[model samples]
Target: MKRILITGANRGLGLELTRQYLERGDQVFAASRQPDAATELQELQAQYPDHLFPVTLDVTDEASINAAHAAVRAKTDGLEILINNAGIYPGASADEPTNQRLGQLTGQGAIHVMQTNALGPILVSQQFLDLLQNGVKARILSLSSGLGSLTWKSSGDPYHYSASKAALNMYMRSLAAEVGHYGIISVLVDPGWVRTGMGGSGATLPPSDSARGIIRIADQLHTEENGSFLTWQGQPVPW
Candidate 1:
């Protein structure tokens, strides 16, 4: 069984991924900012006591990421999969003026979004590099968005969210190049417009469906797929 680590495991896609991985008998390190307060995660832990490990990890905070690494290291010698799924969709609705347009975007809002969505994964990956290097056929998957695609910028709005995701894609691309020789496949995945808090209630796809598709694609990833930007269904997405 693969040893997997997923951030933002308290809800939505992260939660669904955790559940699915545990069901398949994988050892899952479910990282959340408030593990004790996560009722659903706690329930999952009860169901899969031997396979599920809830860890306290705040992606935006470096200290928390280090603490999480230490905690995971104490349990397992390595990690086969690292899902950088913790992210914030600040100003997700167009009604929020801060993310409406370039002119309306606030500096603080953009910075915060970049820190969480772009830099967080980098920091977490750095902290867990040692464990990943020791893993068998290790893979690092970052949850990106189609909005990040420069070729698909039909309507340019939500400056902070869009730009942050774009930056994340670039970072992951570079990371893939750097870590390829180590037998690690690093890539960005677009989970589609799933019905989650970030995706909004009007979204068509369900979180479980998106999670399943992503897992399937992740399972097939290898050195040849490094640096690729792909949809949940394993279709290639233009960077």
Candidate 2:
């Protein structure tokens, strides 16, 4: 069975992805910021027993990320797939009645969002580089969003979310270029507007459905696709 690691596994898409992968009999490292309070994930661990492992990971903290990486490395020599799925979108949406503008966005909120959404994945990916390199079919997947597309932003929409994702895309592209020689398949994936905490209530797709599409694309990544920005359904997303 393929071994996979995913962050933010306490809820939503990350939770669903863990369930789906575990159902397929794959080894899953389900990570969350607060594993002790993640009753659902803990229950999953109880059900899967040997198939699922629970880990505590706070991607925003450098020391925490390193510690999590070390714990995983001790248990397994390599991982078949690594999904950097933890992120945050602070404040209300731009269209909301209580929405805050760029000027009104609190310094703390903006910094937290950027650190979690952009810098977190880059540092986490770097920490696990050696583990991925040990796999025969190594793959690194960063859960980006369509809001990150520069082309879409040029059309004017979703400013804060778009800007954060765009920055994430840029970092992923650079990382892919730097690590491609290791035979690792690295790409930034836009999972579409799925129904989750971050995706909000009006989202068209369910988290399970979106995870299905994402896992499909992730499983089929090839060397030629390195540094490519792609959608859940394998479509190219302009960066």
Candidate 3:
């Protein structure tokens, strides 16, 4: 079984991905900001005591990322999959068109969102590179969004969120080139408009469906697929 590490595992898509991974008998390191308070994750830990490891990690903080890496190192010698799923999409309500618009977006809010959604994955991946190198058919999968695609940007106003995800897509593409020599496949996955805290009530896809599709795509990832942006259903998304 593969050893997988999923960030933001407390709720929504991350939690669902953790559940699906454990169900397939893979060892999972479920990292979240508040591990103890994640009731759903705790329940899963109870069910898969031998395979599920709850880890405390704040992707935006370097100290937390280092500490979480240490914790994972203590438990497993290698990690075959690292899903950088921790991210934030903050702005005005989808129904409301207030602060999130072009000129109205706050600099502070945009910076914070960029740090969490784009920079966090890069930092976390760097810390875990060694472990990933030792793994069997290692792959780094960063959760991106269709909103990030410049070609797909038709209409929407989440300025900060969209910009950050676009930046993330670029970073992962660069990382793929850097890590290709090490035989690590780096991919950016756009899990459609999944119904989560960020996706809101109007979203069409459920977390379970998105998670399942993402897992299927990740499992089939190969060197040829590296540095590509794809949907949860394995459709190629324009960069």
Candidate 4:
């Protein structure tokens, strides 16, 4: 079984992904801001005590990232998969979004979103690179969004969220170019609009379906697919 690390595992898509992976018998390191307080994770741990490892992490901080890396390192020498799933999309649930609008965009708000959505994944991947190299068929998959695609982007809404995801896509692709020779696959996976807090209640897809699709994509990836941007369904997404 693969040793996998999933960030933002307290709820939504991250939690689903963790559950599915554990069901497949993989050892999962579930990372969250307050992992001890996550009741779902606690329940999962009770069910799969050996496989579910909770990691406390604050994605926006360097010290937290380092500590998280250490926590994972203490248990395993390598990590076969690293899913950078932790992210925030502010104002997605708001009925009247003030910060996401064009005129209402504030630098402070945008930076906060960027720190979590874009910078956090990069830092986590950077810290985990060595363990990934020692892993068996290692890969790095970051959760991106359709809004990140310039070609697919049609709306002017949620400027900060969209921009941060776009940055994440580019960062992961560039990282792939540098690390692919090491036999580590790096790609961005888009989970699509789901019925999560970020996706709101109107989204069509279910978290289970998306999470299943992502695990399939992660397992099937080859070196040639290292820099691709794909849907959870494993279909290529336009740049």
Candidate 5:
């Protein structure tokens, strides 16, 4: 079974990914900001005692990422998959102050959003590359968004999230180009609008469906798909 590590495992897509991976008998490191807050994961951990390990990580913090890497190093020599799934949507209120308009995002808001949603993945991937390289087969997945698509955003409600995701795609593209020779596939994926705190009540998809699709596509990625942007449904998305 492949060893997989996922960030922001407390809820939403991260939690569901943990469940699916563990169900398949793969080892999973379910990471969150507060490990104790992972009530569902705790329950699953009890059921699959040998398969799940809970880890605490706040992606915006460098110390947390380093600590998590150290913890994983203690348990295993390497990881097969690293999924960067943690993120935030600061919304229009947080964006308005910088631009002095309701929909216009501010500089601080944009920077903060980019730091978490874009830079965090890049940093985490760098910190864990040693472990990934230790393995025979490895892949790094970044949880980007459709909002990040420059081609699709002729109009949108989330200025901050969209801009950050677009930047994230570029970062993933550049990194993948550099790392492809290592037998590592770096991919950016959009999970679509699922019914979660971030996706809101009107979202059409469920976490289970999104996670299933993501896992399927993730399992199928190759060096050819490296540096490409794709949706959870395994379709290519514009960068």
Candidate 6:
């Protein structure tokens, strides 16, 4: 069974991924900023007490990420999968003060978006490098968005949101370049426009559809697939 750790595992796609992975008899570290308040994951833990571990992680904060790494390290010598699934869309919340319109971006909003979506994954990966190395066929799969594609860039899109994902892609690519020789695969994936808090209610796909596809693709990854940007269905997405 794969030893997997997923960020933002309390709800939406993260939660779905956690559920599916657990049902298939894998050990899952379901991470959330507020684990006690993650009622859904709490329920899952009750059902699969031995395989499910709730980890408290607030990706935007360095202290929180470090603490999570320490906690995971104490449990096992290795982690086969690290899924960077935590993210936020600035335009979706009025409190964010970030709009899609040109010339309306706030520095505070930009920094918040950048830190949560881009910088957070890098820090988590850095802290877990040793454990990943110790595992068999370790892989880092980061959740990116189609909007992040330079090929898909257009006017009036949410600036900070898209930029942050684009930055994540580049960072993961560089990581793949430096680490593939070590047999650790890293790839950026677009889970598609699934119905979720970030995707909005109008989206076409369900969370299960996206999560299942990701798990299937991740399971089939080889060293040659490192640095690829792919759809949840395993199709190549233009970078």
On lDDT, the candidate that comes out on top is 4
Per-prediction backbone clash count: 0, 0, 0, 0, 1, 0
Model 2 regions more than 4 Å off: 92-100, 154-158
Return the top candidate by TM-score: 4
Q: Candidate 1: give the clashing pairs.
A: none
Residue 149 lDDT, candidate 3, scale 0-100: 97
lDDT of 5 by residue, 99-146 (tens): 423567578877888889988989889899988988767998899988
Instruction: Kindly report which residue stretches of model 3 are placed more than 4 angstroms away from their true locations once superposed.
Output: 92-98
Ordered list by lDDT, greatest first: 4, 3, 1, 6, 5, 2
Candidate 4 lDDT trough over 10 residues, lowest sum: 89-98
TM-score of each predicted structure versus truth? 0.96, 0.93, 0.96, 0.98, 0.93, 0.97
Q: Would you list the clashing residue pairs of candidate 3?
A: none
Candidate 1 local lDDT, residue 91: 60
Between 2 and 4, whose lDDT is larger?
Answer: 4
For candidate 4, lDDT tens digit of each residue in 1-239?
99999999999999999999999899999999999899999999999999999999999999999999999999999999999999988776666454978889999999999999999999999999999999999999999999999999999988999999999999999999988989999999999898888788999999999998999999999778989999999999998
lDDT digits (tens) for residues 1-239 of candidate 6: 99999999999999999999999999999999999998999999999999999999999888998899889988888999999999999656445555655777777878988999999998898888998999889999999999899998875568888999999999999999977988999999999998998788889999999999999988999778999999999999999
What is the lDDT, from 0 to 100, of the residue 237 in candidate 1? Answer: 93
Score each candidate by Cα lDDT.
Answer: 0.92, 0.85, 0.93, 0.93, 0.86, 0.91
What's every prediction's RMSD, in angstroms? 1.5, 2.3, 1.7, 1.1, 2.6, 1.2
- Model 5's TM-score against the true structure: 0.93
Which candidate do you rate higher for TM-score, 5 or 6? Answer: 6
Give candidate 4's TM-score.
0.98
Candidate 4: lDDT over CA atoms?
0.93
Off by over 4 Å in 6: 93-97
Mind sharing the TM-score for model 2? Answer: 0.93
